[model samples]
Target chain A: MPETIAAVSPAGLAPEAEVYTRAFARVAVERTDHEPSRIGTLRKAAIDRFGELGFPNRKLEEWRSTDVRAIATTTFSFEPSAELVSEADCARFRYDNTHELVFVNGAFRSDLSRLQELPDGVIISSLEQGWREHPELIEPHLGRHAKFDNHAFVALNTALHENGVFVFFPRNAVVETPIHILHLGRGGDSPVASFPRNLFVAEENSQGRIIEQFATAGDTDTGGNHFTCPVTEVVLAQNAVVDHYKLQRESTDAFHMATFQIYLGRSSNFSSHSISWGGGLVRNDVNAVLGGEGCEATLNGLYMVGGTQLVDNHMRVDHVAPHCDSHELFKGVLEGHARAVFNGRIFVHKGAQKTDAKQTNRNLLLSPTALVHSNPQLEIFADDVRCTHGSTVGRLDELGIFYLRSRGIGEEAARSLLTYAFCADIVQRIKDKSVRRDLEEFLFRRLPQGDVVRQAV
Target chain B: MSLLEIKNLHVGVKDAKILKGVDLTVNRGEVHAIMGPNGSGKSTLALVLAGRDTYEITEGEILYKGEDLLEVAPEERAREGLFLAFQYPVEIPGVSNVYFLKAALNAIRKHRGQEELDAMDFLTYVREKMALVKMDETLLNRPVNEGFSGGEKKRNEIFHMAVLDPVLAVLDETDSGLDIDALKIVADGVNSLRSEERAFIIITHYQRLLNYIVPDVVHVLLDGKIVRTGGKELALELEEKGYSWLEGEVHEEAVAHA
Candidate 1:
């Protein structure tokens, strides 16, 4: 494979110098290979903005609690993977009921994917194809969900993404089966970087679910530097419904940052769930804008981290229209010396009367060294809204643990069961059964022993 | 030989004595009922026996199957054939009842050098046990004790006991919220598990349960200690006269002895 990450470098960005240097080189090579077009201009603008800002430091507002100094120093490279993932690797990330769209190292891997029957009026294809055939569809929604100037990672993702899946469900057409997207990043012995972008549009009265997963291609514990910056946008028309799930399980040396923007039309229902189990420095920026009247939005997340890994989930539910309701729940289980950040905010606009918004963030630190920073904020401009927000950080209830152990469950098993149960509330919200099962299994097998020291102790 | 023996066992929680100088013994094939009003330490003894860490064993020894029970952790005590049916079984929202029961059973079986049961075998075994308790099949598939009615939760507890096949089962107020019909079903489930090598300490507040699952020995606990011991008929007596009468009698006896 032609090395792109080594060709380009960024000079003198003190805090994010290392990550910028690595990302700049990788972005240069990947962008060079892409067919330039009108959409490419917008993506390029995002990249330039990112280059100017670099990765956010502690000085940034949204990144205060989540510092990515480690990401800045990591020696990683990007470009596409040279190795081919065998059929066995494909089987490792399969979902039973849904059609799989596999992207290896940010490029769509056709050999590893199975695209099945689609209902009429439903458009499903790679982002590269969408750019050429349906340029109008990708123009308005791309980079529209995230703020380019404020988010360095968001800008970086827009600038360098080579290929991703694009899904469009036309008016009144409901796709019962979920659309599954698997993004596998294999760093191997050297640095690897990928920018995976996904855009989903549900027209009026349309309903669907999108399940996206990111992980390393094969099972090796090599701590090579890697970064996956992903951007996903969900646009719902009047009375539309969209359920989205993002699963991030990368190598420990990998840096993952994703922005999920959801737009709800009049009377629409949108739900977004994210489970973070891997990544060295992971940050997820999720925003749901209830644009139409009587729209409903639900944001749920569960993050399980161990080792020295840092996982952060930031959520904002903007209640723009009256008679809208939005609920956000985020829970975390931190073991070892792992640290997690949960910041959930609910914003009720002035004219958005009768808005009902609720937000809750709960953290269970199993080890004393396990650190969790939970911040729940509510900004209400209207007086006639019922808005409540709560943030709690504590260890698992001793009484609950004792109750489980008294019933014959071993201590370790009891702890595991309780932690799973704590996160299961959010996992069950996933409408897709196979996706939920896959997540449950991943959380069980890989979550046990990873961190250096127990954080909750 | 006694299946469970607690001699001069004293336990407390957060420096407050809950089980003070309590002495009890239950032989195999016998049912012992510990009846007391709320705050009388009947539940504390059960928790202490189950090796719950909340109740610190300040001074005393608990011998179960001739082993120092207090020295064992809660899970170890469970592996040693000990089970506690919680008065309010925790509602684990994501863990199905069958999964939790199978895990408990497997842990006990592995402790006893028995092979683990795979999915098919566990389903069959648990289905049969669930039928014994007349529990709804839906409850077994749902998360452990979650969304269960009062009686359903109690019956699920007994079903777990039936699966674990513990040598000593401690039912902490298992009959507290059950109707007569549900109580009969739970009593029958416990009766079927009774064997020559197993014993039960059924904790309850009312004598109505003792009517269905007749106890060989009845112990009256008050103020963190077993103040009086009697036959099964004593439950009927206490039910009629009320525990206040027993407290008066114990106080009189203590004064006279002093």
Candidate 2:
């Protein structure tokens, strides 16, 4: 109804046009019912902004490693799932000890969710409710953490997503239990696209943990293509602590594009761990801002890519305040024709003195054909900070294997042992017992054979 | 008949010979101490005997019990009762010490055609062995040799040797990093595991460890060949006289014997 929002004429473009001028027309009509009215206008504005800037290519330094042509040329229809998720199918993902929050097709399913009792001053509600009830609290920090201009996928997530989880902890509150939210992809027999967004705000001196899992419940071996576009933004207020984790295990034929943005206030501690297990082509964009002095941020991730899958995780940590510390460790195991790319960047601003940042990206190649590319970059503007970045791409240590075999461990067991060891450093740092146990078990089952481990994908 | 025999053993690494025409024989229940200066092929001999792939045998025949030992793989050789406590134990991260030892022990047991112990039984078995080395129960649950002190690493090796219960134990400079207290514990562990059916090759540079676990035969190795073979007192003589005493005639005698 707004005059600022424009609808492209049907004659101007096909329903599957590759370029934005024609493509936006189809996406606009297709996502009309799902996209909120206010955010839809904002999305149109952001699209116009991108049109002014144009698409970034290899010429842009940041886009050198990741090519957007493959994603840009792929025509994905904004279709929703026709078949609803069943209770029995959801049981497959249920953990023994977790407060489950189920989201099917980007909409919350209250019947499938099990919310435990919350302490005083804690709020867990839907973003749709927040948009109407807590507009002041939601509007200011909704899209403030991540820079939408840098990435098209995140911008698209912002424009189309209508429903998501909104979590907020009041000042000085300590919520001991971890909140688990499982996002299920359940659009059967058609090409479906979902945009699920999340916003978490930890008030001053508050403490909590959130575990987010994204899984696909469609035919993986069949040619059913599902597209999932997700965004999660977390804000840690002064002296607050947050442990955030995101698990992406979609159907092998699905396309998953996700973004995780976090902002830390003074003396706050924030840590995020991401695991990418399944997807036809998956890409994760994570950005964290160290906004205050003495803040600490840790980013840990493990990804296993196999077959023809292309999995990429691009992250940047901005050190804006002095005396801040950030530690990042990402491991990949790749096999078959799977390809993986990791680009981790640490930016130490001019005023961010006394900053200590350490980043390491390690990859293991199980197959000679599988490809892995890791680029850990450090941009230091301040002379007083200590920052180090390193990337290692190698096969399993032959001597270490021989040492184990000489002690009577079989070749298979020995290789698995060392591969587990390679990933243990990151997995051990996760504080949540249930989350850590689930991930460790998942990794153990998948470690011995996978493109992600073989190729360090 | 000897329990182990090495005939005309010639081993090399990267096309360079490290052990040349080395011949030795040991019967059951005997402990042979091979001593030499650093880089004088002491560790190389131990590695060659343990079937490490880093070295290729140009010409040799190693008879263990009866079959050819050189033809077997290192792990198979280990299954056949050959154990090597490395001079520098390799650190295996993520794999707990207890898990590694349990797998190793089970592999050995399977090779001996015995029933495998279950998880609880294996834990109990290792608990008793841990006490032999005075090792704490907590260390067993940790990553193998990760963040372990040098002495703890040596003690873990001996503890593993006890678990595997190998017929032939080769301790290569196991006492190098150990203090007097750690040395006594490790030596006591090795002594307790000793039996008439098991033979040991204690490889060391100094005679200090020999004072703790006295060997049946002490062989002074100079320039890849044994220059002298004597009793336990020979270690004390070597400690006092030093290898410099055997520079000229000892070298001549080794060459003549070869």
Candidate 3:
């Protein structure tokens, strides 16, 4: 390969780029004696791309609202491989009898994972392990769905990605239990950054459910301003069905930027639910493309922010084949000085006739200072397509509050009930009973007057 | 002692004086019907009694159970055994009927030093009271008054009155948008809740509802003040002769006083 490194100028790359460069050099030297691998080549190409692109600026249309200058300025070191996490740390998020893969600071922890009693043809393991054991099954679809050419964050993640969760469901296999992936970020004295890359593939005629959870360790002081940039790629083959969920509850001072790219085959069905509750600055980019005819996709998200938090959700659904349908619903509740942004776009190609797409974004501002910006767009070129989009930003209904209060419910309880009710529609869309119940409980406890509402209910 | 006493209550909404120096008193076991034309401040009286802040009580004194009612908040008033059946019931989309009623009952019970009922006990109590308005069981699980028809919403108000079982109930235009059958069912529900320790103030524009739930006294409210007070037969007389007769009588009284 030709030399791709340019001279470092005074204002060229960010302060954190030096750390990534040093880490990449160490990894390359360590793997020098090993056999030539496709992942190595991909990593080298990604590092070159990252060096050229750097971090996205505010002038970019996609990064207009979200500013990552703080992240670029802060020096974050890559966490070296270590056994820093314990089983007790993972106890709270574990579910019974379901397969789980745990990652601490972006490194897979096999000691804390439970993969017994998995169904036949179901592969649930760490990404590094999967690449070593079943490279044939992992190589063809690993980085194909999530293209990092244009996205600077995706490029940076691909360049620094080490170990994360990998799940595969073979053809004709149906998994009854959901696979859980826990990404736990831990920080010490210095700020740490983790690039977690996850790949999920459901072969033809298969069915599966994946729950990806991102959280920090206990206590706010422990995680000292860490950064988590995760990228997930999903592929659903012909006649396959998959339900994907991403629950992000990082530390209050953390920065979270995630990208989810999905591809749907012929007659395939895919749905993703992203619930963001914590983090100082969070932005999620979710895109789904219908590659074959008769495919269906559903994207739903809910974000609750308070106390100087900023959360943004940007989604795009592309109808590339005829007879494909996609639906999107995103709701947000913001309080204090928190702000939120929602941008949803639906595109129908010229040849993709009979496409049906609907998008809706609704936000509730709980305080006078809380604000939200919503933009819903539809770009349709097909003459025989039905596409509709809407956006709304409002406060809690005062009359509704008075109605509840007149019935002897306290003002605090009434307000909390209304807030919960505002997000209930999105919570009800989750198909798993346990997941829905857990999310409801989480929402109830997260609201301002949650205790009062919980007791009243 | 009277259950409620409004002495020269002067109320206004924004710039308009809706109720000008209205006086009324209601003792336990008495149903007082205040009939008036449109924009005559009948609904305003009910809302003011319910402690709604929309109306400005410029000069008034309202005593409920020997305590000042204006000093109380709306939720506190509800917990103090005072209920107001709204003319237009609000449709709260996410709160279920059962949950709202249970919360109201528990809040009131807690205020009265009574033990709160569990889910099972609450269901049993609610099932028995729901029959007062002949409400369907399916409606209990649905959101509070959401997508309910006008008649169904009126029936739900009455259902809430029956369930809450307040010491004093203010039914504001409860018979406005109801068919004959719904009117009868609602009137029956109201009658079933009447007791020697309970009082009711029914504000309406029509005398037809008084035929079903006979009131002890009939008061004609013209503009703001009460112009006439008579026995239950006064409603029939007002029905036979229209409200124009009362207006003429009020004008004659004013001329005679001048």
**Could you give the candidate ranking by TM-score, starting with the highest?**
3, 2, 1
Candidate 3, residue A58: how far the Cα is off, in Å: 1.7
Query: Model 1, stretches more than 4 Å misplaced?
Result: A1-48, A74-78, A81-91, A96-99, A109-114, A117-121, A188-190, A447-457, B113-132, B191-197, B244-246, B256-258
Clashes of 1: 11
Query: Residue A110 error for model 3, in Å?
Result: 1.1
Residue B76, candidate 1: C-alpha displacement in angstroms: 3.8
DockQ of 3: 0.55
lDDT of 1 by residue, B1-258 (tens): 677888998888886888789889899888899999999998888887887766678888989988888789898888888889998888877877777777777777888899989889988888888888998888878988888889888998898888888888999999997889999999999988888888999999999999889999999999888888999999999989999998898889989999
Instruction: For all candidates, state DockQ relative to the true structure.
Output: 0.37, 0.40, 0.55
lDDT of candidate 3 over A300-355, digit per residue (tens): 99999999889999898999999999999999999999989898989898899999
TM-score of each: 0.87, 0.91, 0.94
lDDT of 1 by residue, A1-457 (tens): 1121221244534444445535555564555443446555666677666656666666566788787766666655565773556677768778887878988778788887888899997888888787777777767777677677767677777776767889999999989888999888777666666788888999999999888988776763563557788888889999898888888878787888888888899999988788888888898989889999999998888888888989998888898999999988888888899999888888889899999899899898989999888888888899899998898888776766777777666676677777777887887787678767777666666544211001111
Using TM-score, give the best candidate's number: 3
Specify the CAPRI tier of model 1.
acceptable
**lDDT to native, each model:** 0.80, 0.79, 0.84
Stronger candidate by DockQ (2 vs 3)? 3
Q: Mind giving the per-residue lDDT tens digits that candidate 2 earns over B117-234? A: 8889997888888889899888888888898899988998998898888899999999997899999998899999888999999999999999989899998887777768999998
Better of 1 and 2 by TM-score: 2
